[model samples]
Target: MMEAVKRFVGPKWRQYLAASLASYGSLCTGMSMGWTSPIFPQLRGPNSPLAEEPTLQQESWIGSLLVLGGLAGPIITVPLSRYIGRRWLVMGSNLPLLLGWLLAGVASDLPTLYVARLMWGCATGMQFATVPLYIGEIAEDHNRGALSSLFLLFINVGFLLAYAIGPFTSYWGLTACGGILSLFYVPFTWFIPETPFFLVYKDRNTEASDVLKKLRGTSKEAVQAELEGLQALVAREFKEEPKISDLWATRGNVKALGICVFLAMLLQLSGIDVLLFYMEELLVKVGTKISASDGTIIMGAVQVVTSCITPLVVDRLGRKLLMWTTSLGLTIFLGLIGVYALLDSYYNYDMGSWAFLPLLCLIIYMILFTLGVGPVPWILVAEMFPVKTKCLASGIASFMCWLAGFIWTRFFRDVAASYGIYTAFWVLAVCCGVGFVFSATLLPETKGKTFDEIQDMLNNRSKEPKPVAV
Candidate 1:
């Protein structure tokens, strides 16, 4: 077993371990997102864990509070990362994550649940702001997409866990499981050192050179060359560390931030979060042939399977192509779902065999979603910004991403409740069509490109002769 593992892991395993450990926070976030999928029914039904059953409005709050708290976390992460560094921040995040789960595990009332979910969201948002920036610094251009896309892979596994396990586990039992998972991040962190870019930026060149050697598994000369490149980039970019205002300083920065913000909005407006959080409820309404619980589990399993394929193909396929094609694909698939929702909900039609249409539509929807907008936008956020404004820009973009999620998930239930779910589905389908147009017209291909190249492309300066990133 050890021989086989060594054969697979090879010498550059430190970078992978570092990226995966940092992304452990995403697993906790996924559990929080997926928790509502199976548990929503129980929360509002006879199996209620709270003192009283939650109404639809209350349930929306229950679902959106974590997202609402997402808005708060990025605000904290930007400044905190300056002092603690990405590795430490990623490690310490487990405290709040574990606390959130413990609160859920013992909660007896609605307010406690709200606070717990919000804490979960805050912890997730912090990771979102830090992990990608950390990964981008550590990974080589050749495999950056594959490594960064692990963010989605791990989170989707968390999604699968909740959907698969939530149905059978008691309410508190599931929370306990999540809290246990949160503790693993610390041990993972112990195995990996701080990112070489971060160490260089902090003026610890000796340590940075040593760490880079370990992460790159290269010889002294090669490591020294790599270290020098990072030193120049860090010296130039960090002469004065970037502020939120600095993101708007250069046209490249402005364009990069805009593109990232737009993509972030596009990702959430696709309404993937609504499905993750309300899969059981949505299927129950769709009247699928399979039980909603079964459908939710299958959908989640599909996410994990499909997500695994993304990291393999993302670097090969290129970012813009996958994003453009999948955006259109989502537009088509989501429209099909809207049609079934229209027939079933708006017309009050009852059919025998056609009941499988929504289920089929959603299955394909998850496929396209997981392949493209679901994961690619986050990668783009990590790629587009330069090191100078990376933390600030990333925090801004993540804030927009979660703010959009909160808006979409908060009102989706109410929209479905008010005008029938068909109305909500149709709206998302239209927005996805817009996303398709955006990707084709504006989204730059980040495949095999460095951050400087990406920023230049965003600013229409890629063709001009210039030095590589300092």
Candidate 2:
């Protein structure tokens, strides 16, 4: 039966399945992140389920608390990633996500809602901390970029599900959708093999080789060649045994750390996550010709479609190209929206002739964003560090990302309330512009490169940049 299934799935089926299942973690996060956009209206409307409409401060907390909860997630998973291995860590993350949604479903007050979001954040943090580690381990040198980009693809799908369903369903029904999806993900993960890299690191050579055979689905000679190469690479990278403190101990590791952290910060500051969280509210403020809910649905659909196309092109176009192109595009569109917001605010300039500009600008921005900034940073982070420091290094980057999201989402309302949304969009445009420079000046192209080669590139092992493999 297993052989028949393997034949149907092709040679790389295990790698694709593992990545697909791991991405379900990101799917839960998208659902939770986009949850606020549609439901905030119901919660704040005249027919509210809570005893009262939440105060502005309370609303901010409700929106950002999941990110706040994400802050604590790495503290738990970074340590556990080594002890339990990547497969189990990913499988275990689903428990908290399921519980978080269930809690949100039963909540009658602000505090319960806060705790539920916090739990979801923690689950999200854990997934980000480990899935990239798992992905980096399983992917072939030839297809790493395409496989890693799968993370954001499913995330957009989850976002579309929430945005499409939220307007039509009751609050409890949406919460149930989140809970069921998370619960549904658990059993599928049980079939995937533990990463061969993790097994090699633990000196389980026989099991590692067996897993390699399953993953490659090739002749024993081919599997053994890859396995032997990995064993040698691990031995070299893990010299003297690494600790968490080593995340900043060596200059090379520190360089990798700085690059990944900066990229992660740029991703959040590009205004993608916060904008998704507040899509409906922003559309209302911009006063689009179409209804806010309809606009949100359209944007979500675009994200889902573009994200699928990105994975097909990322390996071919290369990382730096996509990052630079997307950053430039996001900057221009964000600046355009800021202009409309400025006119709409300071001048009370009625956009009678140009009402479509805001939505059009937004739709274009989402397209460029989904192509690169949305997923590439995660791929870049996964490629930067060796397994020895991956958990600690990736965890720090993940922490910075969530911190940025919390700061941006938590304060966006206050800024929009006082200065208008223009202020925030203009600020984020500057950030995206900086992202363009960062990609052009500092980021390396890792397309089709092996992990050993990437580490060598970071360590300055070669005077010239390695050419992207055909």
Tens digits of lDDT, candidate 1, 341-363: 78776787885578888888899
Error of 2 at 89 (Å): 0.6
For model 2, name the residue pairs that clash.
Answer: none
lDDT of 2 by residue, 1-470 (tens): 65775686678878887888888779888899899998898898875668899887888888889888888778888887667898998888887788889889888899889998998888888877777778878889776766777787888888888999999998888889888888867887787678998899888989998888877877677799888998997898877666878887766688888888887888888888778988998998875778888999999999988887887777678889999999989999999888998887678888879889999999999998887887787667667776677777878888998899899889888987887788888888999999999999888888888877887777788757689999
10 residues in a row with least lDDT, candidate 2: 1-10
Return the lDDT, model 2, position 382.
65
Clashing pairs in 1: none
User: All candidates' lDDT scores?
Assistant: 0.82, 0.84
